[model samples]
Target: MSTTAHSLDRLIDESVFAGRIYLDGEWIEGGGGEIASIEPATGETLAMVGVASAADVARAAEGAARAQREWAATPHPVRAGVLRRAGQLWEQHAEEIMGWNVREVGAIPPLAGFALHVTAAECYEASALPSAPLGQVLSSEEPRISLAEQVPVGVVGVISPFNVPLILGIRAVAPALALGNAVLLKPDPRTVITGGVSMVRIFEEAGLPAGLLQLVPGGAEVGEAMVSDPRVRVIAFTGSTRAGRAVGELAGRHLKRAHLELGGNSAFLVRADADVDQAVNLATWGAFLHQGQICMTVGRHIVHESLFDAYVEKLAAKAESMVVGDPAAGQVHLGPLIDEVQRDRVHTLVQDAVAQGAELRAGGTYEGLFYRPTVLANTPRDAAAYCDEVFGPVASVVSYSTDDEAVELASATDYGLSLGIVSKDALGALDLARRIPTGIVHINDQTVNDEANAPFGGTGSSGTGSRHGGVQANVDAFTETRWITLRREPGQYPL
Candidate 1:
């Protein structure tokens, strides 16, 4: 093992660091070769992870198909037990997991800890699903007992992204498994260790049966294979809107269901009645958290014209005050972007917006992969940063004169995953929130937030209407419904 792997040996097993793919109850080399997981903050190679080819994905899917029957047949309590144990394991290894998250995803300690906490909470919440009501009795027109029941969707394919890998990946995995479905997980190669390898280890240690969850780390090809695989009945995807469209289209072609949780350019509104300082604090946290990599991060800051200038100035000052560095090396408020590709994309958006007449109130530069938190004022609606999802630490501020205008500006984008409205008048803010079409809304809070039991998803380009979380949503996403009827005697059929 290399020096980096040696350093991680205590946190992660050496066997995992040996760079193997977990499939079909075995750890083996991937047919697609390997990818090196790099630390964005330092540009250091943390681990060499095996990459799964399309063929490997097919094999994993087939194995999952075979294993699902038995897993579904297993006692519900027993399955729930495994998920409970996984939740405990997440908490037990919180420090270690946080360490991996910091190195793999350029996450600050608090963000990494948040991922850990949410992941554990997800597992714990999923544990309750097994015993939840799965079926309901219905009165039949004829003399027969009718029932509508939920059943596992067989093998489920989960494709997760690099940002907030643990939480995004586990939210689907835990619920699907607790519902007695097999899973084939495809994590981004950049975050293979934290997202893929850590998951496999956790389940294995928790006594989950083999072949139930396969970890395949690769890029688009592997994801495509999983989505197209006949054995895979459902696809749970979390990623860019561009990739989600392809996944949804391919799943449709195959006549399968896909739960797509795609990208978002959420809006954060500050009304004239709101406290300017408080609004600035919320906006900074919403826009700069995890370097603004979250899909729910506030991409558009819509402030009332009366408080717009003050909000911009305060936000810019907050951005400048934040420290950016390698989270693993020292204390810093923010970390680097996941890689140079992401850094460049973020910078390009900021530059494009400035060229289009958006005033650069603060930031718009980088030292290495660490992008300075950016604040833009007078951003044109057509500016790339304002119109698109920058997925970086960028706060694009725009002013609105009235509540109606604020709603119009906030709802302008094709994406509508989350919305935040700040106002002392709770009823008025709620009224404004009701007008916007979004999956989640924060009355006093910022856009970036999540709970394991909440129904999470969005409308429009953000995602399919299918949500993830809560007993009902989880059942709907990972299972299928069947109607059964029983007759006391032989019933005459209508001719």
Candidate 2:
């Protein structure tokens, strides 16, 4: 029960660290083997998590389906109360939650705090959904009362990633559960504690009924099993574009609705009229925060050709000035990538870009998993780092002469997740922002931003439109509409 700073040994109950899975109201070993949950910053095994097998996925799904009837019939205020309590619990246990976030997922304190704040807000926002308007009266040509109503899609399957695990997992889980649908969460195995275990504890303490929300953490096979389960109706998936495609395809094959929040190679456009220093600061944060693993990270810095030199120079200096280390040890601007695989991928992209004639303005190295903030100038369009979603702390800067050219360069990517435009004339920036087809756009700001109630998703390769936030989007995502017609008595005219 150590409550000291950076002390994560007892942040969670000892039982959670014993490698159990939460299923149908109990924490027990699933039908699978064990896997070690490692601390990426120190390469230490945090816990031995018991993996979930295909059998476990089926049992959880079946339990959720059976329990959903009672849950949906529960009073709306009671369901909403559970969500509100979960929000309070998240804040009450902030220290412990943030600690696990740092060690398990490599989030700096601020990033971890952001995850906590957003997830709590998500619970609060979802609370209102239990009582939201779910149906509408409609006119019918026949002598009957006609209505269109929203009903829970029963046993939603949530597939969340490691980056910002808490927020991503809860954004879907909270809303779906609040709306009376049972959930089967399949978090990335690399982040089971923060993403999966912590979630179960929160909702359980909040008084949610057992079997309503199950936590099954494992690899892709587990997710595949959950998706293919007939009891699971909708799939809410957040991950890379490549993986998202597979999930989408599988969900489609199963005849289920899949809400996909995929990857991004988002752009930050700096106009010639913008203040160079201010733009550089925004750019640096956009590309370096959370080691640039965010889906909305400003991967491509489209700078005005006139200010390109100064932008590159200042960005390079900012990158070099940043310190990368274990966040739990001390204050550092950036932390390690999730694991060695990500580290290798990020480093390889940076090196390949440099080898392809891109000028390495700063960085292109790593010490353990802590990759330095990298900046590349004049990166070729074909370079992997420039065109693709590198998912690293690497900035690819390219010069654009006109607004149209900037729009072209920004829209050329397969992703349309997020966009940022900075200029002295705010109206001008807003006008230019409209030209780019991103799901989220920030004027005079950076790319990475999220709010609990905002409609948050991207077009194109980024995701399946806005399916994660807002009352309308969540209702549309987790529930389906049914047309009902009622008659006082049987009235038949046809023979």
Q: Report lDDT per candidate.
A: 0.91, 0.92
Q: How many backbone clashes does candidate 1 have?
A: 0
* True lDDT of residue 144, candidate 1: 89
TM-score of each: 0.97, 0.97
Instruction: Report the error of model 1 at residue 43, Å.
Output: 1.2
User: Clashes per prediction?
Assistant: 0, 0
